[model samples]
Target chain A: MSVSTVRPDVYAQVQHFYARQMQALDAGRFADYANTFTEDGTFQHSPGAQPAVGRAGIVAELERFHERFADDPVQRRHWFNHVALEPLPDGSLSSTVYALIVTVRPGGTPKIGPSCVVHDVLEITEEGVLTRSRLVTHDQEAA
Target chain B: MSVSTVRPDVYAQVQHFYARQMQALDAGRFADYANTFTEDGTFQHSPGAQPAVGRAGIVAELERFHERFADDPVQRRHWFNHVALEPLPDGSLSSTVYALIVTVRPGGTPKIGPSCVVHDVLEITEEGVLTRSRLVTHDQEAA
Candidate 1:
């Protein structure tokens, strides 16, 4: 019988972290979302693009993203599903999740944005919070 | 310092399997795609749907799917990326991949279909072929 080596609690913590992170982003709480990462966390929008490193950098990038939809009537909802987390050798965990971004506008049908996969390297901070190190791998060229 | 427990060869194999499977589907080789599965393998299109069990069932389902675009000037390309594989204690390997399906129609803008995640349970057969057991876990209801 094949059984998962990861503890059930680890899965629970990872899931909850993702849920809260998405909520913070959808609520335009850039600071809260950035707090989910480590001090030197990184968010790579695509494979060849420059990653936004550190909490400050992440917040800056997300703030700019939120600014795009601020004046417009468009709302973006990020749906992350089918998350799989595995414990790595050094105690940090690796996770993969598929993100579906839905764009909603007044008098317009909801449109789905680019579907991409995010592979995350997560570590538990001293506060026992799950913090991301690297995330999001896409096919786009570097900015 | 962190190192992956999954070997380099394992990643190579998983990547090759997805590449071949997608090629087979795109080339309309339903049989070839079906043959990638075990005799009693299953394909689940969504979370709560009846899976197409066995090779014959897989072939039949895929053939019907192919027929939908046969006469139309539509092309479907399945891109599987961000693949993560973990070795199970029972010798089987578990993998998660994000799939982006692009649909292109004659004289129409190419559209992206549902972006979803697929968690596959793969086992190597006696003949050293990677065979999948369960595949495709999406948020949408089963068709």
Candidate 2:
């Protein structure tokens, strides 16, 4: 395993990338959120789960998510913390972050949905940094 | 109103600094947490709240916090996101982060406390980055 420090600029780039990506998703901009990933990017909900491959597949999954919550008036916000980035030997970046999903309904208290850890492989391109793959694992499942 | 992009390394530095500082506090290492600030640093909970001045004063306030939660068996975690940093004319750094405080008791669901924004003036010291001043404002208060 190669362990190298990630440069500051790279860290900032990844941070900004997620900040923009999550904001787009939370705001219901499915296409914009999917664009943050590579055309062939994959999103796995958990280990052994069928992955959403490619931009269209990713957008389909997000649309399903929208429909699933269509009846709910609650707002959901994704907060990422403890973002640790590692420079891979292939010139990509391996990033791990704690993902907190907070949901709030009108005039109701905010609730944390579940504790999760997101692992991402990011590649830099002429367009900026984009996630090549992402896998999210619930804390309970990890235990 | 200079809006310069923060360098990647500087962004990484600030992220690691907060990660370490928040972990120390959540772990109940009050003194270690207070040491992340300068000797004469100030911590204001809100706009009109009296600030805790100096390391000793900070520790004293933390001790009060410890006592307040002594009877509770809940674990508290501080998650920070959307960290925006700016280089100041005086060579300091201005940092603003959305702070989420999550609390979970054994076998209970996790809940988010109040939403907050923390603003800090950071100075690069020989020992790395240290907070010179910190002010936290609740989201409701801002509205």
Candidate 3:
């Protein structure tokens, strides 16, 4: 699998795609978040975890994840950096980024939650770039 | 003041420049970090703060800043996100990013320091992309 640097236009498109996707998820727009993915997209939270397959399944899993924080007043922000994009031979793009989960409550200092590395396979369609597969790995687990 | 999105190649170049620049600063390579800037590059930590002018001055100021934590065992990491790039009419690139300073002690969780927005004027010379001027604004102060 040869991975090469993506063109500038492709990089810009991917960045914008993530910006919208993360914002939707953080703002509790589960359906909108799922829309950023393909109909058959898969999301694996971690290794050995059952993957959330397909758009509907992804939304269901995200809702369950949000339920865990329903009673919490803390706001979570996803910060991504070191976004490295690679062009794959199969025409899909490979994007790897370091993701930081920052949580802050009203009148409190922000804290860093789990640090993760996310690997995403992206494909371009009539609607622009969308995720085809996503796998997140916790930093500690990787270490 | 017309700003437009940068070409894909420029974006990649800027990203790589930052990866090297930030690593040099965090690893205590003050001179190496300073070299990432143009000879007359300036760094202003916050609005109304006296800016460190030139590479020599920038290195000196950074050294002093590091001295304040010399006795501390905490490791500081600079994580930047939402890196937006624009092309300026003068052949300079304007880059803006949200920066988070994360500090962690041995065996302890990471805590976020001041959240800041950094605006940088970048120029590409024979040596690649270099910072011509940088201004950082604290989120709290902006609010």
DockQ of each: 0.07, 0.18, 0.13
**Model 2 alpha-carbon drift over 4 Å, by segment:** A1-4, A140-142, B1-12, B20-77, B81-108, B112-143
Q: What's the residue-level lDDT of B43 in candidate 2?
A: 91
- Superposition TM-score, candidate 3 onto the true structure: 0.62
Q: Candidate 1, after superposition: displacement of residue B131 in Å?
A: 14
Poorest 10 consecutive residues by lDDT, candidate 1 chain A:
A134-143
Tell me the deviation in Å of residue A142 in model 1.
14
Clashes of 3: 1
User: Model 3 Cα RMSD, Å?
Assistant: 6.3
Two-chain DockQ for model 2:
0.18
Candidate 1's error at A132, in angstroms?
2.8
lDDT of 1 at A32: 89
TM-score of each: 0.55, 0.61, 0.62
Top candidate (lDDT): 2
Candidate 3 C-alpha lDDT tens digits along B1-143: 11134555666677789889998988889899899989999999888889999999999999888888888897888877766666789999877776888889899998786666689999987779999999996654423
> Native-vs-model 3 lDDT?
0.80
Better of 1 and 3 by DockQ: 3
**Candidate 2 lDDT over residue span B36-73, tens digit each:** 88899999978888999999999998887679778877
In candidate 1 the C-alpha lDDT for residue B66 amounts to: 67
